[model samples]
Target: MLVALIALITTVLYFVGGALLMQRLKLTAAGEPPGSRGLPRLFTLWGAAIVLHAFVLYAFLFGENADSLGVFTVVSLTAWVIAAFLFAWSFRHPIHVLGIVLLPFAGVTVALDMALSGVGPATPMDPSLRAHTLLALIAFSLFTIAAIQAAVLAIQTHMLQNHRPGGLIRALPPLSLMDTLLFHIIGWGFIFLTAALATGLFVLEDIFAQHLLQKVVFALIAWVMFAVLLFGRFQFGWRGRKAAHWTLAGFVWLFIAYIGSRMILARLLGV
Candidate 1:
């Protein structure tokens, strides 16, 4: 019941905040709006969901059941803080479009958190573990933003190659901006992924033969992909469609790494 209520509220926030966030990002005929209206109110719903989930965190932590699933809550909260900060920072620049992508992503995460935050040994945070976890998660999150940028870049590059523009393409940030953001995100994601893996190896009892091992495999594959793309970008000067394609590929590996783990853990094991 608690999970249902949280999901329902977050779902509403997604719709309401997502729709209004779009309007708040309304571009003018001249250019992007004012360049500084600040974050849209709809985004507040996302924060509210994050804050609300803290109750769940506390409950599971202190509740008689002491569900191990509290780890999901921690993960969800970690993502929320990172996304919120990223969105807030990006908004100060020309990355308002990111809000549209991130808010919906976060909404889905909230729902997932609710579903999963019901099992596990309830590993409470220790200083070193928390530090490693936060760094890894923030790095992983950058890949998410990179994924969104990749999608936007692909669409823009397509329109450019075909010599068509306007509509959603117009709504996109400049292609160069998108590309720059992609590389930037990939760079951060790679670095963070490295840290996350390192931390996981230290924190876990067994690194291999578990779901975490699978996640590490996929993540390493993603890191390699990102590394190759980065090399290509700098050395071979891969740009336009090739860059977009590589970005998408790398982000796909990243998606499988974490989301796949969540799916197996939550759906199959009921954790």
Candidate 2:
């Protein structure tokens, strides 16, 4: 009951904040500086809700002899971390545009986790594996954010290409700046994912088990895709639509490798 309440409150705050931010954006043209009169207070409310949401997760998802991860747990935790990252990044960057989409998604996922009582089954673990798991979750969260950013960049690019640069387009950072931020995020997420994969291969006892092998294969493929995209960016100056496409593709494969199977098994098969 408490968890449900927390989730509900968090979802409401996210929706309210996102809606207000969108309304503010609608008030200005494409290139004009955004108004920021109430954003600080809005952020304060968001931060409080996020902190509470994290606490709820700690209470329910972690405790003595509790170390299980489920499909919903993974998604909810990743969204929580992404929200934290966005909250921090907002101080240094104009990424509130992302919050407009990210917050509502986070809210819905959190609420979904509560609704399904999806506190995934507990698993006994080796201490060493914990670090790898943390790295994997962080990598996933970062890429998730990158994917959303890439989506926004793609939309902005398309609008500009066809000369529809009003509304949200004007609210976005310059196209080159958006591209720069996207690659920077991808670079960091790639490094973290590489580390996670390396640790998994070296540390896990049986990464090639039948149920797990497909995940590893997909992860390796996603890693290679990101590597190729990064290499191309530096070597051939890949940018604009091509970069956005690669970013989304890399994220899709990563999602498949990490969350897709669990979702199928848990939500679909009731396993």
Query: All candidates' lDDT scores?
Result: 0.68, 0.81
RMSD of 2: 2.2
* Prediction-by-prediction clash tally: 5, 1
Off by over 4 Å in 1: 1-11, 24-75, 119-128, 209-211, 269-271
Q: 1-271 in candidate 2: lDDT tens per residue?
A: 6767878888888788788677767776544455677788779877986887797677656754356665666677888888998888888888778888888888887787777654554334566677787788889888988999999999999999999887888677789988998998899899999999988876667754435777788899999999999999999999989999999999999999888866665566555
Residue 205 Cα positional deviation in candidate 2, in Å, after optimal superposition: 1.9
Error of 2 at 163 (Å): 1.7
RMSD of each: 4.0, 2.2
Clashes by residue pair, model 1: 68-119, 68-120, 68-121, 69-119, 69-120
Off by over 4 Å in 2: 29-34, 119-125, 208-210, 268-271
Question: How high is the lDDT of residue 242 in model 2?
Answer: 93
Q: What TM-score fits each model?
A: 0.77, 0.92
Worst 10 residues of 2 by lDDT: 117-126
